[model samples]
Structures are given as structure tokens and as C-alpha cells.
Target: MAGSLVDVALPLPVYSTFTYSVEGPVPPAGTRVLVPFRREERIGWIVGAGSGAGLTRVRPILDILEGEPSVPPELLELSGWIADYYLAPLGMVLRTSLPSALSDSSRDYLTLVGKADDVGTPRERKLLAALGQGGAPRRVRTLRKALAMGSIWPEIRALATQGRICHQTVPPRDPPVRTHRVVRVMNWLSDLNDRENMFRRASRQREAYEALESSGGSAELAHLLHQGGFSRSVIRGLEDKGVVVLEDVEVLRDPFREEIRAEPKKLVPTRDQAAVLAALGEMLQEPNPPPALLHGVTGSGKTLVYIELLKEVVHNRNQGAIVLVPEIALTPQTVSRFRAHFGDDVAVLHSALSEGERFDAWRQLREGKKRIAVGARSAVFAPIPRLGAIVVDEEHDGSYKQSEGPRYQARDVAIVRAARVGALCLLGSATPSLESWQNAQIGKFRLFSLLNRVGGGALPPV
Candidate 1:
């Protein structure tokens, strides 16, 4: 509809979507919109649109925040399921799917409209004085602390009514995309022979070119120089000749920057591990496979089995996989192992990362730049394209249950999400949860078990 009415849900305690009018073109259902509500502006998600038949007067949506729908269609369905199944607030459930850094967090600040010399109350006058001294709008919280008032809303509201002050909401800031310099061999060069004449004249340039060619014909400028023992002049000269190209490419900011890179270890699976992996592989190929329960003992090498499966899912199938750990504290070790295996194809998601780091990581996964997502519970909701597998490590742990807001169980959500994308769900735990065990017992899930540890480490005599 060109100019129709839409229903939107605000992040409030309310249960129903409020109707609003659209003036020109209508945004898609999942786009965020700014609307005037109760004398203030509020951010809401557009759910659906219809003819405004029974309404007397409808307010027009103030602004469409994003050109594209912020929430994906699959997420919208998942949010609805969570709300219906858990009795959680629909708005809260939708909010949980977004990155916290991308939330509509705006703070109201006050600006003096006129002279604050004669304000209403003694406390109000003091608050105005503080605002006037700053010469700019001050956040409500800043005034509360400066004036030492427990609740300043009444005072602020009074000031607004007196026409002596103005209020505005400051939108949250998004982190900037990071970029780095890179070098690539020019296509015209074709082969080493094409550079033979130039190589004789400039030995250093030849060395740099050969180094880049050896490393797949592209590399970071800094890395190329370091590996070739060449100077910037050599690179510049090659660039001037059009033999090589230099450009800046956007790169994600890694949160664990100081951590040294670990090498992916090779392992030979035991007979039991091999048999189980084969069964799991068969399920992965099915069009609509059932969820799987991986039951193993404490010393069993379940993590290594997951690593092997992910390697095949990502490298062979060119698909994505998500690994969910139970705790934020466990993310670093888990992330390091995945990165060691998948290198740049792995992205980490968790609460412990800075807002920028998390945003960048999420972007990489969404844009198909990264193929594997690893972290705690929230990682289950990662925007993985063409998802092939989902691994819930420590599925029996209680930390996978979100205790606040939406109160969703990440393990359950992972299974549903995998089904939505035609991916295989693997719930691995030393002591399997009763729910998963029951599912395996009833044939809802395929069951596999790891019986012993690697390296023949015998258990203690008990």
C-alpha cells in the first residue's frame, strides 16, 4: 500500500501493537520507526499494515530509522514463537534479538528556553542554575547528581510546562567501520615471467612481488613488507608502474587482539568417535533432520569432534556453523580454538566484548565475511547465512537459560533456529539434560555417545 496504516510495537510493558499512519512510502514490517507517543518520541518496530478503517485520528510515523528492515524475517518468526511459548513480552523478545549497541538508547536532556533566574521551586531553580552554567543541554541524570535530588522528573516536568526549558533525546552513537591497507598483484602481470625484465632492474621490487605471489597474490602491506624484507620505496615504485595495487579494506576489530594465535591441532578419532561422527554426518545430509544429543563423559574428547565437524561444514560445504558455550568466561578459550582452526573465518560474539567489537563481529557474520560464530548463549542468534550446523557445547548447563527479560532457553532456540535454516542441531554435554535425554529416548533426536578420553589416560581406580 502506498499510504496505509501500520501496526507497531514499542519496547514497553504493553501487550498490543499500536496503529500509526504512513504518509508516502511504507517501510517493511521489521523496520524501526520513530513515532510521537504521550508527548514524547519513542522507537518502535513496524509489525504490519492495513487500512485505517475504524480510526478517527491517526498520527503519522515521524521517521523511518533504517532503509532496510533491521530485523530479519526469521528473527521476527522466532520472536513470535518465544513470546507465545514463554509468555514473554513481544517487544522485549524482539529487542533481545538485536545487538545491545544498536539499541534505541536515547537520554533526555534539558535546554533553557529563557532566563532561569525565576524558576518554580527552590530545588527547581538550583537545577536550572546548573543547566544554565553548562551553556548546553544537560542530561537528566547529570542534573540529578549535580543537584543531589532523588527524583527530578516532577521538577523537570514543571519547568517544561512553564515554557522555560526544552527537552530533546540524544540518539545512541554507532561505532565506525575499521579499515586497513592491503596490496595485491596487478592482473596484467599474469605470471613471474612477465616481471623478469623489471626484476633485473629492481631486485627489491621483484622480491616483494614474489612474496605476494607466494602468499596467494595478496596480503596486508605491512605483512608483505615484513615477509619480503623490502622498503616502502620498492612498494611505491611497483605501484607507480601499475604492477601492483594498494587499497584500504575494512576489517573487523578483534577483541582478543593481544592473544597469540594458536595452531589447529590434528587428531585421529577413536573407533567410537568415528562411528558417531559418521552417523551425525548422515543426519546433516538429510533434508529435515532431527536434532542430535551428544552424550559423553567428562574426559571424552567431544570438543575435538565438534572442531572436525565444523571444519567439514565450513571448508567443504562452504556453509556457516554456530558454536554456543555456556558461560562468557569460557568464550576466550573456545574462541581461540575456533580461530586456530578457522582463522579469519571465525567471529566471536559475547557480552564481554566491547560494543564496537561485538558490532563488528556481528556485521562480519551477517555479511558472509565470516563462516563460523562462537560464543556464549547470545551466539545462538548470530546472523549466519546458509547455516549448516549448530553446536551447543555444555547443553545441560543452566547458564544457557536467559534468566531476565525474554527468559528464553538458548539451547532450545538453537534447535528451532537450525530447523528454520535447514541445518543440523548438535547438543553436546557430559551429563545430558533430562529434556534432551528424553528427546533422544523418544526418537525426536538422534543419540551419540563418546565413551573414553584420548591418549589412553586411564581413569583413577575407584
Candidate 2:
């Protein structure tokens, strides 16, 4: 049996994970634990389980808040690695990984949902009445100056504690908590017989037990079972052991896809296209294959090739693909080409979508509402499971690099994401980036060269 305590890292201005007790109820690592932070109860993102320090003084968590942890441990682990590698704070890394809403949970007075009445308390009523008598929801800052409440947070908290009026954080717009029904395997850590059973279990069961063992305690079900695909019962049993845990961190989805389906299309490939596609296809089938650079000159039907391969991958129904283009290329004409063939099966993520629209689009991909996602840089994070391939049009385009915030280069990041997800890559460009050209010459990627247009249109004044 695993220990009953854990350390959870809340993504905040701080950098460390807070240690808390989970003896009575075994919540998963990604659970959002409402701990007694400082003097107030605050929500902290959970990292993993640990033995709560009994040797030293510590406060128990206020309550394991309802809902699943939104962030996955693997993502948390990866984000932590990125923060460390880039010399960034873990909390800042969490901030970037999380949505814009989680950091700010405060609320304001507004027209209550479905009702117009001021549903606030006396203090809140005072503010709301003032807003009602004068005009509308006043900025708390301005309200503080006008109402002389000193600091509104306390009053807001008190008023909020009553549920009389709505605060800025009435209900989290992008709630970080996702409801996850998890079952964990339980073991008698105190029983010597349990250790013997673990060693002699069936191969599949033993493999799972061993993997969890390697995890040092808590492991995400999806990740730990990726190899042999363990049963939910097994997970439950582990939880019984107080080892396998489940919680909801922020659940981030591929901001582009809403469903998973093969929006395959037939490709009218030229002879060059046919040959190159076959060759690259073969290359992708190899073990540990590198990215492929398809030097399809401008108007060389690279899009057609994309359709062909995507059709093939979807036809298999076991994997999916992502098509990345320059953000500017998502203009109507460019976007239309893929949509004309794929129809509603394609989801595009770009700057055009409102925050709500963007979140919904991302949710669609995350929920598997859309399968194939195409967009600018951020689209690289599409949530499609079992990604089979990725096609980067105009791989050399400078717009692929993101300059702010995460400061990650899309083309490079796509390569990393593809490798992590076992997806094949096709980098097509008329004027290839010098780096790509160099990679091609060195045999780092299979290079397919396209020379002429399919058929002559004007005959060049011959």
C-alpha cells in the first residue's frame, strides 16, 4: 500500500508544491485540493501523492474539492521539465499551461443569470443598490473609492460566503475541475501476502503492478496502461491499495478538434506526387523515423498529397493526422481548400475565434468532437489521440515561430509533438527554409523533390 499523504503544486505566483494529508480519502494526484493556505481557504492544483509529514507540524487540506483535477500529471511533469529547462518558475509554467481564467477567481456585480433583481447581501446590497440607483456594476476599485469599504475582497468574501450576490468568480467560466469517476486498486500494504501476490500475478497484471511500482506511487491511468491497456477494475484495486489515485487537474483539449473522424479525400496525385508519396509513406513506416521534408514547389499539389495521406491514415481508423499552415495561410482561400474536401470534419483554430469560441473549439478537439485540426502555431497541441501524421505546409515559413509567452517555435515543436505522439510529418515548401534544406541534405529527413506543374497552361508563347 502507498502512503496516505501527498504534495500538490498549485499553479500560482509561488514555485513550490504544498504538502497535505489524504489519509481518510485517497484523492488522485491531479485533484484540486482546497487547502488552508495562509489564513484563507484557496484552491491549489495537485501534483502527486506523498506521505504527509507527521514528524513536523502541518495543516490538513480543507477539503478535496468536488470535480476531477483539470491538469494531467504527464502534462504537469512535462511542463515542469520545460520550466526547469528554460529556467522559468514552475508556477509560471503552470500559468501558461492553464487557461487565462484560473488565475483570477474574483467576481463582480452584474445582471444575475436568468434574473435581474439584486440578489446580493447588505454590503453587497449597498453596492448593488448604489449601482442600481446610479447605473450598473461598478469596478470594485471605483466602488472602494466611492463606498469607502476599505478593501472589498473581505466584504466580497463575506458576501460571497452567503451566496446573496454574485462576485466576479460567481462560477469559474473555464472551470479547472473536470469530474472524473476513477477506481483504484487497493492492497493490504500491511499484509505480507499482498507483496507475494504482486510478484506472482499474471503477466498483464504483473506488468501493470510493476509499472505502477516504477511510478513511485501515483500514475495516471491512461499513461500507465498505454502499453497493455489495464482494466478500470485494476485501477480500482490499486486505489484500494491507496496507490493508484485519480484527480482532475485542468483538462486541456486540442483547441481545434471537436470530434474524431476520418475526413479522407481522394488525391489526384501527379506522377511525381505518386512516387514521392509512396516513398515517404515507406519512410514513415520505419522505426524511429525522422520528419520528412516534402519540397513540393509552389502550386505543386502539396495539398492534394496531404489529402491522400490523411485519407490513408483515417482509412486505417487507428490513427489521425494534423495539418499545420502559416497563420496567414488560414485566409478564406487557404482554409476553403481543406474544408471543401473534408467538410465539417475539419476544425480550424486561429486568432479569429473569440475567447469563448476558441475555448469551445479547443473543447471540441479535447472532447473528440472533431478529429482533424488545422490552424496556426498553437494548433500543434491538438488533442487528437493516436495521432498518425502531421503535415506542415510551407515548413520554411518564418511565421511558424512564436515569439512571446511560451516562446516556442511551431515547426520545431510540431516535430517534438509528433515524435511524442508517434505521428508522421510532411514538411512542404516551395522555398524551403535553410535549416530544413540542411536537414534534408544530411539525410535527417526523407526529401521529395517536385519539379514542374502538372500540365502547361499557356505553352509559354511557343
Best by TM-score: 1
Q: After the best TM-score superposition of candidate 2, give how far the Cα of residue 248 lies from its true spot, in angstroms.
A: 26
Give the whole-model CA lDDT for all candidates, comma-separated. 0.82, 0.64
Instruction: Give the best candidate by lDDT.
Output: 1
Runs in model 2 deviating more than 4 A are: 1-44, 50-69, 72-78, 90-104, 108-171, 174-267, 456-462
Report lDDT (Cα) of residue 173, candidate 1: 47
Alpha carbon deviation, residue 171, candidate 1 (Å): 4.1
* C-alpha positional error of residue 105 in candidate 1 after TM-score superposition, expressed in Å: 3.4
Candidate 2 RMSD to the correct structure? 15.5
Reference-based lDDT, residue 314, model 1: 91
Per-prediction TM-score: 0.79, 0.61
Residue 6, candidate 2: alpha-carbon lDDT: 73
lDDT of 1 at 197: 70
Over 262-290, each residue of candidate 2 has an lDDT whose tens digit, in order, gives: 45444568899899879867766765568
Worst 10 residues of 2 by lDDT: 107-116
